[model samples]
Target chain A: MLAQGVGIVETIVVLLYLLIVVYLGYLGWRRTKSAADYMIAGRQIHPFVMAMSYGATFISTSAIVGFGGVAGMFGMSLLWLTFLNIFVGIFIAFVFLGGPTRRMGHRLDAHTFPELLGQRYQSKFIQVFSGLVIFVCMPLYAAAVLIGGSEFIATKFGVGYELALLVFSVIIAAYVVMGGMKGVMYSDALQGSIMFVGMIVLLIMTYSKLGGVTAAHQELHAMANVPSLFKGIGFKGWVTMPEFGWGQAKYDLWWIVVSTIVLGVGIGVLAQPQLAVRFMTVKSKRELNRAVLVGGIFILIMTGVAFVVGSLSNLYFYKHETVTGKIVAKTENIGVIAKKKRALEARIPCTLLHIDTNNDGVADVDVVEKGHDVVRDGQVVLPASKLMPAAEVKDLGDGMVEVRPRAVAFLRAVVQTKDGWMFNTDSIIPTYVTQALPGWFGLLFLVTLLSAAMSTLSSQFHAVGTSIGRDVYETVTGKHGHGIGVTRLGIIIGIVIAVLLSSYARGGYFIARATAIFFGLCASAFLPSFFGGLFWRRMTKAGSIASILVGFVITAFWLLFIKDEEARAIGLCFKLFEKHSLLLDKPNWAVVDPLVVALPISIIVAVVVSLMSKPPSEEHLRKCFRGV
Target chain B: MLGIESKGILAVYLLCIASSVLCVVYGLLSWNRGETVPDDVKW
Candidate 1:
């Protein structure tokens, strides 16, 4: 297979790049004269490094593989989320969240995200608990990233999934554990450059393959309304939009697209730990300023390229397949049936189907399971045997609606197996990448996959190590101030655990689900206190604690209890020893995009709780509020 | 986006330039420390 030969050469080049990264990490390790150097690169990094590091950390494997895939499934509307990511995730996050985090980091001499939060309120419990949370959850997130990377390599390079996972995970773990944040940042900048070049090249190649944008758009437009069970609900027979009512065809629903993709990711970007640390790395506000321009340009290109190419995937697929029924299994006649069934029957994933055999809102009741149980009614309901008609849900004058079941059930059956517009919920990136790139170009595309996965995994490992070494290890042993070497050991432990979790992980959308849960929990606890501590002078320690605790608990409850169509698609699980959840479906938050509901609640609780609690010391307020 | 349906790569290039300008302007406005940003936390 000369194709395989090209792939092998590509792989070797990538490995060489990785080796250089590991060497940079070693240099960072050697440069470490103190804890600060290891953790924050002595807080004296240049703006260029800061920007690249921020970009690298932000564009995890989730971007290229997971969300990019989603764009393949949905149409390009997910591109709006990419725009929001740049504006909110980067721009607002940098201007709004970055400055204070730096000041707070310096004031408290805090190193990690947990340390910043913990020291802000003078609570060891906060630090330890926050650390524990990151340690415990980061692996799941890390594993998901590993899975995305590994899956891509297996798909594109013809490497075994297990082998790819091990190789990629091991490389990242080695660098992160050995290098620390500086190593991570240094490698991130390099990886980020590759990512930037790779994405641009990918976009060019994608367009070239399709003959041009006009041709691509022409082909894509043909599938605009080919045929679907649900037409009135604006189901453009495209996977990008959900089926609701006349105004909701493919990309029509402003709320679903804005709420789930835009706000969920956009706002959540402010609170991510790995990305936050980059703010603290730069030498001064000047460097931060310089980074703003460079980082903005880089991100715009990276994300813009991803969206443009990803949206054009429809064209590539159409060119390749030439079947107008639309390759998005969800848009297919049958896929429309599944959504109809799920909506009408109320069969969410946890149960594997919508039947209320157990009658609990939890799809917890499964009739029979295939591995993880694709659908459950306390019995095996074979997916729809044939195409089902789409149901029309008509608007009754004033925002009211009624659904026709037989038609809905027909669409649901097709959707159960065939992907349609709703298929953008997951697996879209894989489909598009495979279709868009051919031969060496495809192999080059694999570099994007590899870089994304490795960078994300590095952050996961770094967070895991930092959390365990400082929080769990210190807390359980009641030991304080262990040397850096000891913490490196803790990092090793976290990596091993992450490897195990990823190896056994099974979800079509492990990355999105894991990211949602991780960020949701982070937002619940951190967003409230982080903002309050910086803004409200009267925010008390008692209020902060209450807000964090309340936020964490409520968000978890909502995710575990509430069931929504978006959530069911991603799936969810809990605990270190989680059994195969009989209910394959998860709540909307399980995809776990947190900002939609979790954020507002976090803010409200923090404000209210702070008002009702003791205020921080006047001195503490002065330190936090001095510059402003 | 005006007549985006009709124009081709030239529109894309022009749109790109306009976008960059907006981003630069936005970054400057936000970074201007002489004025305080709403909800910005000053530590």
Candidate 2:
């Protein structure tokens, strides 16, 4: 746990922050008088607030802790994602889509994103289906944020995970359900500001600790020759892109990094319901235009600092010596050696053991021994016969025997450490924060993480509520102008679902994968239809319906059947096909994200279907495109 | 540049900063261009 023994300071700071947040929620609740106010902040939100809300909701703990951890493992190649976030997410979104979306939303008298599309196409089915998709699919994302934040709170404050999850959900639910969009956005502005400041400090501290920016990166680059588990799968170094090639090993990392991490969330931001609805929160296109500046800088700082600091953390870990356990046996008996290995494994916090064979204090090989076989990189490098007499020894041919363990003790080097636990990539930022930075910064960073989580969760809950009240319930029951009660109820239900999912889902990459799943799903399901509705006047109701349905089905199919991470988690592909992914036999297809496949096909379908069907009525088009 | 050896990574790193500058320029240039409210709008 980070910030241990400083619980009093952290508690006071966290309590004060929560009080301010709740007060802002109360202010929003007091101001919200009508459906418009509750739904879209009366469509008169300040440009700064709207932009910050949009950014805060867009970047969650998933971006900082989850994706930051990814940066730690994959290195500065993730800077491409930071670039896309600023260019595509902020510049393109605000400049190209923001004005049109705002105009069309107002002209059509639409409140939510689904309502905009539904009113534009004059199809209640579009609204209801889209609402259902968001309500159903968004919980996974909310859970990711929930888990990320709760984990931090639990560790920082020494609370149980369950208690942290419950408290986190309750606080977010209270605000979102009461204040609605106004509360969500107001709180988001504050949280976003904190995140901005926190990230800046983190970057400055990191560079200073590592000498300077150039020196830090150079040190990371120099450590590229160090033995790493990812080296087999095309990882070259921390400062460079993964080795690019068509071979299976190289192509896998490239696809996962470029397609999934960079492009998936990059393009996916355009169609996020929580984010797009912010365009409608503003009065004029000028606000959206003005927002572009703030949004760009905010996103750049948030993602850029995270990725840079994450990559640089490698230098810190390499230079610092962590607690390690050394095991030796006087006798070279096979049974006695195996028993000693088991005891050593029980003592260590990590599963995959790394041994320093040459006594240089650096780990030479990461080995997973099964019975008498010593495996490295999934191959039996030391056969049972080799392990029989020598107790795991390899002659280096340079007169330096690389002995694992025989008559002498072998030094084992654990990776990074936190509270005596072996640190994985997910723990990199947290470990770095607790160990390297000043204790005061931990309090601020904790608040930053909480703010990130709560801000995003608040918007997600608000989106879910509005989806149910405006799109699903109204469309289904033919009710109009009366949705606040149902919306509040929906927020509660959404919070419960998220809490439940967070409790059940547990893994090393769970947070990152969940975030990517939602982002990729949103891109596949919403991007084509949303883009077509905005720019193309010819896009018809049938085209949108077909695109949404096809995009959704294909993405779902890919997640359940092709993507190894999701498929194995769901266990559906394994149940039916007896494989983690159906494309396990096929090379890179399994790793290829659903967004890459579904989004293009969805776009093509939208174009073909819109062209083939009767174009939208000119009168309707004029009404939708009134101001733009 | 920036102590990064890979040209690809260096380009991306530079582009991130450049794109933010581009956004700032665009936002400043167009700040007062689109403030007109549509007629017959109700609030």
Candidate 3:
């Protein structure tokens, strides 16, 4: 109910954007004649198109909506991810892995990551197993992206969440099922360009509205306070890194800043299947080389702008809003006051009740009286013994304290609620657009968000479908002839599964959290096997299978068991074992992610198991390692 | 000297923009080094 719009001009613009997207899908479908064309765009994509598609797929509403919203709550500490996205995701991924992946995939004639592994090792088992894992686990990720987009639309149009999700899912699914990889990439390129323009404009507007970069951040710095839950880290501490330590308060900050946000996401991007296949879509090493700058700039504009604007939203809210309690009038009747109290409680979202203690000019103290308090005309009374001091009012001694309005609102609207501050974080970006921008631009920005979600979702659906068709069905049935039909069926199935999962993918969760979770899962499951197959001559078939299986199992175990909140969400914690996380009790290292635990285990198991077994045959080694 | 917050904010913008520009320059400079498709790998 923030701001609803169905203006004629905005509606026309949205409809026009959708038409162009559908047309692009049709163009891709027209060009896609064979399985290869459907899967990898016939490996003839231009460098710019490849880079844009890769970047567009890599960044989605996860970065812009979920992470941006989080930035509003967590402050600028999240900017470390921008550095990692460029350096690790774009530079290392394209420069170090891109050329070799393209070469090796070509050498093996591999259409998918599972197919690549299966071919390199000459093992149908490795291919089918990897494909099964992708088919099963990828829906969680796709669902997260779906929710990110649908929620934004729901907020913008005042539609129900279910209806918004269905419409967005069906539209993206139509293009993905029809166009395949070629259509996905083409639409991705268009979307990426749109996102770039939208984000740059957004960042400029955010700064201009707040009076400039320095002024905005300075205001943010002033507004900083460590909420009670964080326990130790103050606002300044949240803004900066904790000095390296395992001590109580410092570890909480490090756990959040480093273990979860930075490393879990940063290092995890190297092995994403959707991103890896992008390298194979283009022709040469030079294409990848050329793509580096384009991808870097695209990501910077997409993610950098999001983080900047997201954090700057705090300044906007501070200047424009105040949290107000209902006005109390002087009266003498206890019965009328009791009735008014109940009405006020029902009316307001805030829990705090303001009472004029001395019947003075200004209403004196704000008390969060849960179930008991006497409100009478002119003055009110609460049991002095039970009242704990409100943190918003700092005691300056002499029975006097200064009250901070923003701080009080923060305490009431965020901390005092059952859900934490991050509960409202996901809505920040959309709310900003609707409330802050002009009407026409808000509609345009909505298009940018839809493009972000659709481009990524299309890529994900295509990747999952191709994995099932090529790696599982084709490998099992030995029918490479009817591959396109099988893949199209797989696309539909993937969309259905993702839609189902998204219905359960809500509740105070940010899209970026789900994104990072999947990235970490992929890195743990695929990195050891993929990197080993590429670089190590002695990496045997048994070793690769063992590594992949172990990595997948460990990542699943950690996410569904050790991460208490995630475990509870999945209905796995109490039913399967205990209700609480195993790591929740371990205060020093509770913030460490499953990827941290799983990746090393996968690598070690792969290396040790490979060396213990017989080396791969000379012919296999020559084909895989030397690309003979 | 500028405040830490100002410097940090500036760095985020500069780093992103600089990295992108450098990439474009490098790509343009090396554009001619790419070989045409080899016969065996031609799609």
Query: Who wins the lDDT comparison?
Result: 2
Q: How accurately is candidate 2 docked according to DockQ?
A: 0.70
User: Model 1 over residues A1-628: C-alpha lDDT tens digits?
Assistant: 0112233577687778777988988987888787778778888886777888888778877777666654544445555666666666666777677787777677666778877777778787877877777777677767767767776666455556678777776677688877888888888888888888888888787777767766665655566554332343334423234433322233334444455555666666777777787777764565666676767777777766765665566555433421111111111122221232222332222111222212222221111111122346676553332222223334444323332322211112111222322222233455455433555666666676677667667776776776777655665676766636656876777777877876775334456556655665677778778887767778777777777777777666555544233234324433321422323243222222445566677778778887887778888777656663
**Which residue runs does candidate 1 get wrong by more than 4 Å?**
A1-8, A228-234, A237-256, A320-431, A472-480, A564-595, B1-21, B25-43
Per-candidate Cα lDDT values, in order, are: 0.59, 0.79, 0.72
Q: What DockQ score does model 1 reach against the true complex? A: 0.11
The list of candidate 2 runs beyond 4 A from truth reads A321-424, B36-43
Error of 2 at A183 (Å): 1.0
Listed for each candidate, the true contacts retained, as a fraction, are 0.06, 0.78, 0.36
Total clashes, candidate 2? 0
| Steric clashes per prediction | 51, 0, 2
For lDDT, candidate 1 versus 2, the one ahead is: 2
**Shift in Å, residue A391, candidate 2:** 22
DockQ of each: 0.11, 0.70, 0.38
> Which candidate comes out best when scored by DockQ?
2
